[model samples]
Target: MIGVSHIVVDWGTSSFRLWALDRAGAVLAERRSAQGLAASAAEGFETVLETHLAALAIPEGVPVMMCGMVGSRAGWVEAAYVDTPAGLDRLTEKAALVPSARRPVRILPGIAQRGAQGSDVMRGEETQLLPLIREGFAGLACLPGTHSKWVRVEEGKVSGFATFMTGELFHLLRSASIVAPAVDGAATVDPRSEAFARGVGDGLAAPDMLGSELFRLRAAWLLEGAGPDAALARLSGLLLGAEFAGAARFGGRGPVALIASGPAAALYRAALAQAGVATVTTHDAEDCVRAGLHAAAVSAFRLERMSA
Candidate 1:
C-alpha cells in the first residue's frame, strides 16, 4: 500500500481488469467487471474508470497503463498497431498517450500482421507476450480465448501469427445453432471425458469435416441418445482439435508454449495432448499480462527508481 505507484488495466471487449501495483510490480489492490470497452463506451470510459478507482480509493495522479480494447478505435482512444517483427522495446516506444486525463495515462499498442495472408491484429495479448519476448523465448505460442492466437516468436520478436475463431464458434454453436439443445447445462466441457477424446480424434483426422462433425453432435444426441454433457464436451474437443490441425499447417515443429488461465487453460492443455501436440510450458494469463504491464510501466515511468 505504501509504495503503490501505478494502476494497470487490461480492458478487453467484454471484460475489465485493473490492478493497483507497487513499484516492485506486486499487486496492492485489484478490480474487475463486465464493464468492458463496449459497455464502458456506452457509460463513458472516464466515468466507468473513475467509478472503479473511486471504489478502490485509488489516489489521484497515479500513472495508469492500459492494454486491450481500451486502446481500440471504439474504446477510450485509438492506440495504433505496431507492425509484425516487433519486440518489447518497440511496444514501449509506441505506447500512446491519452489526452486530457486528470492523471498520466498510456495505452500499449497492439501488434499487427499484414501481408499476402491478409491482415490480423491483437490488442491485449501483446502485453501477455512481453515477458516471453524479453526473455528471448523462441517457439510456437498459443493464447486461447474468444479468438485464440497461434504465434511464432523467434529470438524475442513476433514474426508471424494466426487467429482462430474456435472459442467464438463454440459460443455461437452452443447458444444459437441447431446443436444448442444438445449443448445444455453450463456450457462446460470435461477434459477427461471419452467423448471429448473421440471428438478430438475425429477433428484431427479430418479438420475439413468440421461442418459435418458439428451436425453429427446433434444427430448423435437425437438418435443415438448421447447426453448433453457428452455432446458439449465432444463439441469443445472437436473445435479445439480443428484449431490445432490448422495451426499444424504453419509447420511449427517444437512443443507449444500455452498461455492461458483457468478453464480455458485446462481445456487447451487436454486438447493439445489429445491432438499429440506436446506442451513444453504453460504460463498463467493473469501473471503474463501483469508482468507485461509491469515491464512496460518500468520503462514508461522509470519505476526503476523505486524498484531498485
Candidate 2:
C-alpha cells in the first residue's frame, strides 16, 4: 500500500507482458518476455517476476495486478472464473490475492460462458474488453487469438459470447496434420491476396465442407503444383472464414468492435470485408489493455490516492 505505484501484468499462456505505471496511471516502464504462465510455472512465477521487477528497479510495497492464465488452475493461483454478465466491479471484487508474494499481488479472474452454448472460458481477453465497458459500448466484439472470442455486451456487462479455435486449427493443420505438406515453408498468408479472398469465400459459403476444403489444399498442391502461398492463404482463409460464418449470427448486432494487434487485425479486417462486414471499429489492443488495467488499478487500489 505504500509504494505509490502499480505494476500491471498481462500474464498469458504463451507470453508475459508487464507495465510499470506511476500515480496517474501513465506507463513509466514496460517489459515483455516469453516466460508465459506455463513457462513461469516451471521457472517459478515469483522468480521470473521478481527478476523483471528488480531490472525495473520498482520500489517495495508496489501492488501488482495481473490478468490472464496466471490465475488459471494451472498458473500461479486459481483465481476462479466470474460468470457471464460480469462487469468492472465484479472483476475487482473477485480478484484473488496472492499471500505468498513479497508484495501485494492480485490476479483478476476470467469470464465463463456456460450451458447450451458449450462451456467456454476466456482469461486475459476479459481485461482487454474493459475499455468497451468504460465507453458503455453496446454491441458485439471480436477478440482474435489462439482461441478467438465473439462477445456480446449490453452496456458494460458481457451478455453472451462464443469462441472459435481458428488460429489453433490453422497452426495444427499446417504443422501437424496431413494438410501440412501443401503449406509447409509457405509464405505467410497475404491478407490482400486472391487466395485469401477465395478461401474466405469458400469457407463462408460452405463451412460444412471444411474438412474436405482443407484436404483440397494438399490435393491441389499434389495435382496442379499449386504454390504454397496459395495453399497457406487458402488454409488461413478457410479457417477464419469458418470462424466468421460461426459468428455471423452476432454480426447483425452492429459493427463489431475489433480489438487486435498487428497482423491479426489486418487479417481480420480483410476477412471482415470479404465476409460483408460493412463497418468496422478498431481499437489498439495495447491502448485498450493499458486503459483497462488502469481502471482495474483504480477500482482495486484507489491507485492515484496511494501514489499521491
Candidate 3:
C-alpha cells in the first residue's frame, strides 16, 4: 500500500470534489465544496484548498493528484493541453509536479485541438474519459456538461474530439434571454410534450442552423403566444437534440456511450431515447476528473517503474 495516504482532487469551474484514496484506488474519505475555480478567482487558490481540507480534517503529508480547471491557465497552475492522439505520458510531460511540504502533487493537463480553421480545449472532461478507455469500443464517447464533448476513442486511444457550448447556452437562454420571461427556475423535464420532441427533431435535422433557431424558443412564446412552460421545455429540447445530432456525426454507425454521471447525463439519455437511438447512462458514479486522475496516476506509476 506504499504505507502512505493519497488524495485525488477534481476541482472544476463551479465545485470541488476530493477523494482520499488508498493504494488500491479505494476512496477512504471524500469531500466536496463550492469553491471551484470560478468561485476562487477573487480569493487565492491555496486558500480555497485550505478551507476545504480543514473542513474535511485532511491531515498533512497526503500525496495529492488533481484534475480539471485546477491546472488551467487561470487555475492553480498553468498546465499545457496535450494534443490529441497523444498518450498519458505525453500529457503528464507538461504537468508540473509542484513541491509541497504535505506530499507530492501532480496535476493532469487539459486536451487541446487546433486546425487552420480554429481551435477548442477542455479543462476537465478529458480526465474523465481516461477511465472510460478500453478495447473494442471504436466509436465516440459523449460527456455532457457546460461544454459537451464528443471524443473519438479508437482501439482504446483517443483520436480526436469536439466540444459544443450546449450547457452554457441553455443556462443563458433559460434565465437571461427575454423569450421565456417567466420560465420557472426549478422546472423539471417533461418527456411527454410534443414541443420538446419537436425541438429535438428540428435540431437533429438542422444543427448548423442552431444559431438562428434559438430565437424560435422566444419567438414561439412571445409572438405566437406559447406558454412559459412550453418554451422552457423547447429550450431544453433544442440543446439536447442538437447535441444528439451533432455528436452522432462523430461515430457514424458504431455504438455511442454517454460517460457523464449527472443531471445532464439524464437529460441526454432522455433525448437519445426520444431520437430512437440506443443509449446507456450512468449516475452518481465516479466523477470524470477523478477517473481521469486515477488513469493519469496509474500511467505515471507505470512510467516511474519503467524508468527504474
CA lDDT scores, all candidates in order = 0.88, 0.87, 0.70
Residue-level lDDT tens digits of model 3 in 1-308: 23324667888888888876656566666888788887877787767776666676776655567888888878877778887775555665666575542446678788887784248787777677666663245566777788888778766666788888888988887777765474555366575677678788878888887777778766665677767667777777888788877677675224567776656666777677777776543423365556567656655544334223
Off by over 4 Å in 1: 304-308
Which residues of candidate 2, in runs, are more than 4 Å off? 1-4
Model 1 over residues 65-113: C-alpha lDDT tens digits? 9999999889898999999988889999888998968887899999999
lDDT of 2 by residue, 168-208 (tens): 99899999999888887887789999999999999988999
RMSD of each: 1.6, 1.9, 3.5
* Candidate 3, number of clashes: 2
Q: Report the Cα lDDT for candidate 1.
A: 0.88
Instruction: Rank candidates by lDDT, best first.
Output: 1, 2, 3
C-alpha positional error of residue 274 in candidate 3 after TM-score superposition, expressed in Å: 2.8
